[model samples]
Target chain A: MESILRTENLCKYFGGLKAVQDVSINVSKGIIQGIIGPNGAGKTTLFNVLTGTYNSTKGKVYFKDRNITNFKPEKVTKLGISRTFQNIKLFKNMSVLDNVKIGFHTQTKTKMLDAIFHTKTYKNDDRICEERGQELIERVGLSDLKEEFASNLAYGNQRKLEIARALAVNPDILLVDEPTAGMNHIETRNVVELLEKLNSEGLTVIIIEHDMSVIMNLCHSILVLNHGQKISEGSPEQVRRDENVIEAYLGREE
Target chain B: MMDQVFSLIQKLRAKSVYFLVLIGIFVLIFPQLTDNQYILHISIRILIYMLLASSLNMIVGYTGQYNIGQAGFYAIGAYTAAIIATRAGYSFLLILPLCGIMAASMSAFLGFPTLRLRGIFFAFTTLGFSEVVRLTILNWRTLTRGTFGIPGIPLPEIVNFQISTNNHFYYLGLFLLVVMLFISHRLINSRIGRAWVAIREDENAAKAMGVETFKYKMINLMYGTFWAGIAGGFFAYFAGYISADSFILDESFAILAMVLVGGKGTLVGPIVGAIILTILPELVREIARYRLVIFGIAILVMVHYRPQGIAGAKAEGRRIDVEKEYEAGISENAVETTAPGN
Candidate 1:
């Protein structure tokens, strides 16, 4: 399979501290890869660098063969990369549907004048977008709450809604940061299943998750990070039994 | 059964069309009820303020930028119109656009840097700016005539016609208000409107959504201030006088209060607010000073009870029609998949 994203020694720093230092991992096309590490292992920071949420301190990031080391977040999104924040960032006061609609704004090309007049073209495109938004909402099983305030959604549904929102951008690769952070086991299982389903559709997914079971079960390949550096990379079974991985998780062994 | 009842309810609601028609007829016949030029003047003032409040609401309400220097733009407009008509001896038609440009340019200049600050900080900065503009007008005695103000400002003379009386200006004001209201309605329903709402709801998210946050914000400020300037010019010409005291912080606060009390983001809310508040003191002319006290009390009570105001809370709330359209689409599939036979 072709590599969809490649990072070469991607580094990010905070003053004297290196949050992500001399770390690199390749994500192949249509694979669900997981970056697993304990708290402060820089999994989220690495994800940020990939999605252009933060500019890299050094090194290069290539998305679909194009080196995009320091593009802004929206520019990165327009280039077919999207992400969901660890803490939910939905437009809270807006309806769930509107929150989803905003993601599709990148795909829309209607002129301002068309929107002003509610012209035939504008109305037609708007109707199509509305339909597409509704479809995505249904696929995530939150169509029933489309008109509910985003702030009012159940925690699990909100996470699912975030995925649906990311998908609305029609991205080639999705960088999800801790989708199951606050979810219960059953919700976590639901999310794993959803990610698997999305991956089956040929959508490339890279997840940063702390849950060992979720990482081992859903991800085809696992990359382990310790102190902002990659320590191990291989299949789930290979990395799971690695000595460095064990040392990273346990800090010290008997 | 529910659908049937809902359709029937919709039919009953349609009866409001006839009620609105009756009101339209009454409004047409209203001025004939009293030939009092004072009443005509009051009506025209209310209409002008309604237009101003609605325009100002676009910036403060939809874009989530609090501008307490709205009166500064108003002053810019009034002075531009006054100077052009009086000193340069320009035609009324020519001076209006010049006034708009002057106000818009000043608004963009102020909005560019200060928009970097958020919430209360932005509000206070604008308040300070209004004070600066007022002091400039006051101390620039040679240009603005200081507190002496401008006098004998010519009434707008059209082709072979002069709007020299309250009635003539009433028609002129009415025409402008209608044109402004139409433009506002179009603007708030457009892509720029969505950009404003997005910024208001979440500035970071708006930028992340590829919205040019600063550029759109400047545009919002420019549009709002441009209209306000024109309305201020209308006020100067109508009153046949211009002064710094008339366009003060109190007036800015009054307009802000109007938008808030009427529901900030709702299209008709500010108009309703301005009309009621502008005409309110006339009924209490006996205790005119108490008018401010009463207005203050009313605003406090309204905020405490209904912060959402008369029309709606946020822009999304007022857009029930769009939400319902989206909801309908969502419901069809959800109901279909969840239920085999519906």
Candidate 2:
């Protein structure tokens, strides 16, 4: 598998606490890579560093053969890397469609003068966002609630909406942190199906999950972390049999 | 009953063009309807406040940046117009945009460093900036004449048409207000407006979605303060005098109150607020001495009951409560799941 995103010895620290310690990850193109760990195992910290929300204390990140370390979050997004949050951060006041339309910010180019004068660029941008945003909302099965305020959506629907919003960026790779967190089994199954469908469409995904069944069923390759270090990395069968992963992450079987 | 009233408002909003035309005709024929100079003067005051309140809304209401020093930009615009018109003998046409530009540049200077500061810290910076502008105007004797102020400011002329009478100033102020509102409407409905709202909603999420939060915030600040300058320039010519006393901390608070009282996010909210607040005191001169108290009470009522102001979107207060509940629920779940691990 050809690697599209490679992090070389990434290290992010908060004073004396090593949140993500000397971790290197290589994610291949067109595959769903899973990162599984116990709570406070730096799973989210790694996502934060990869998405440029936190500047890595040391090491380098390369995306599609280009060095993109220490870039701003907006810049990373502009370069076609988009992500969702562990705690959903929807614009609660805005409509579902408006939230999706905002995801197209990097792609649109309507200047201040253009907007004031209602110029051709403004018309084109507005039309594109309206049509494409509606399409994306439909894709996520939120068409019926397109006009509804985001905060009004059910917990499962809000999770789907976040994925729809992330997909609005037309990203080359999607980094989703806990997409199924706090969801019931049915909601979790639906989310897993959605991720699988997206992956089938050739969209690479990097997922952080605590659900053992989700990681086992969805991931092409799984990496298990313990205490800010990668303890095991291989196929699900190999990881399930690994002594360190069993002791540190998945408790020993009865 | 409240739902019926809201539905009626919504219906009225649907035909807003007709209402605007009716209101326009009335305002145009208003000076003709009455020969009373005081009525025209009061009308002019409403128009000026409408401009100030709406411009400040762009920052405070729409973009979610707390600015309590709008009077600072107003002072900059007023001084720019006074200095240029009095000394350089520039026409009103030239001075108007220059006033906007001058205020906009000053806003950039202030916003660049302070916009990074969040919440009350950013608010205090604006308050501090307002005082600094007033003090500078008061102490700069050579340029401003200090306590004496710059008097005898010539009446503004547009291609030899002198704006002398209260009625004339009323028309000029109306024209400026319309221009400001038109531009604001255009910006608010477009991508720039969306970016501003995105920044206001969640800065981190907006950045994740590829909206440049800082750049958009700067744009919003400059766009808003530019109109504050225009209002100031209009004031200098309308009063035919310039003084430090006009732009004070109290003046900034007054403008903020107007935005809050009317409704922050909606276009018509500030206009309604400007009309009601500006006219209420004058209509009841007996209680005019307690004007600040009335403003305080009104704001408190709005914050507790409406939260979105008079013309704001319905159920905004309820939405906030829902968000808070959702957050609390999430935190509780987090605690339960992590309790045994720690």
Candidate 3:
């Protein structure tokens, strides 16, 4: 499979702390790749570096063979890589539809003059945002609550809205950090099914999840992280059987 | 009863255009009905403040940037108009946009280094910037004429029609306000507005959604300060004098109070705020000495009760009420069906 995203020995350090040290990851096109790790194992740090939220101390990130190292988050997003937060970051005061409409920021080009004059570009872009925003909301099954403020949504629904907002970016790769965090069993299953459906539709997904069941059931391949270093990388069966992965999860026998 | 009230609100919202037209007509003919120069003068002040507050709203309310130094931009506009009109002898038409552009450039200069600062740090920088502008105006005697102020500013003329009367200034102020409102309304309803609100809500999320947060913030600051400059230029011509004292830190706080008391995010909120805050003091002349104290109380009450302001978009509360009503309806149906079986 063709690799869509490749990182070369990416290192991100915070002074004395080596949060992510010389970690390399390769994500193939059109497959669900999972990164699983214990708390404070720098899974989020890796995602932050990938999405340009943090500058890697050393190493390069290549998106489709293009170097995107230390690019601003907006620039990274415009290059068709969108992400969600581990802690959901929906525009709480905005309506659900408006929240999703904002996701199309890069795709729209209505400047001050165009907006003030109500030019053809403004009308066209506004219509596109409204129509496509509605479609994305419907896809996330939040059609009934489109007009509702995002803050008013249930936890699971908020997560869905975040995914819907991320999807509005029309990204080639979607980096979802802890999509199923704090979800009930049913909600977790729903998210798993949603990811599966999206993967089948040809989106390259890189998910950071803690639930072993979700990783085992959904990911085509899993990368295990312990102490900011890759402990195992393979199919779920192979990772589950790996000695390092076993010791990392269930500690070594006394 | 609740349903009736909701329907009534919906009907009012649907007919809001007609109501706006009626208000517009009233405003258009207000000077004709009133020969009172005091009322006209006060009305012009209200209009100018409306412009200032609304512009500041774009920064504080929409983009979620706290800019307490709006008076700095206003002073820049006024001084730009005062200096250029007196020395260079430029037309009001030319001077107006120059004033806006000058202030916008200053805001861009200030915003470049400080837009990265979050919360109170950014706010303090703006406060400091406003003071810096005022002090420069005061201390730069060579250019600004020190505490003596630039006086005898010629009345603005449009094709030989002199804007000397209070009524004339009121109309000019009204025209400027209308233009600002029209442009603001258009911008707010479009993609630019959505990006601003997104940044205000969550800067990181806005970035993740591909909004260049810094660029947008700078744009927002410039657009807002641009109007402050215009208002200041208008003030220079209307007041027929320019002084450092006019654009004090207190003036900045007053404009901020108007936005907060009236409502920040909504366009109409600042207008309402400007009207009440400007007119209320004149109406209560006996308590005019305690104006600041009263403003403090009003802001306190507003913050305690309605932090979103009077005309704020109450999406969260309104939606929750609707959901409650829907759940109640379902429970009612359940009770009705069980009663028939019993």
Per-prediction TM-score: 0.84, 0.94, 0.92
lDDT of 3: 0.90
Candidate 3 Cα outliers beyond 4 Å, as residue runs: B1-19, B315-342
Model 1 lDDT tens row, B1-342: 634743563464468588668866875666778789888989888877887888789898889899877888888899888877889988888888788789999987888888888899989988998888899999999888999988889989888698887778877887887777777777665556766777887776665665667878888888888888888888888988888888888888888878877778777679778877887778878866676676687688666655666555442333553464477557533422332121
State candidate 2's DockQ: 0.54
Candidate 3 has a TM-score of 0.92
When 1 and 3 are scored with lDDT, the better candidate is 3
Off by over 4 Å in 2: A184-187, A250-254, B1-18, B318-341
The Cα error of candidate 3 at residue B102, in Å, is 0.9
The worst-scoring run of ten residues by lDDT in candidate 1 chain B lies at: B333-342
Clashing pairs in 2: none
Residue by residue across A98-140, what tens digits does model 1's lDDT show? 7777777677755557766678867776786699889989988
Strongest candidate by DockQ: 2
Report the error of model 2 at residue B5, Å.
8.0
Ranking by lDDT: 3, 2, 1
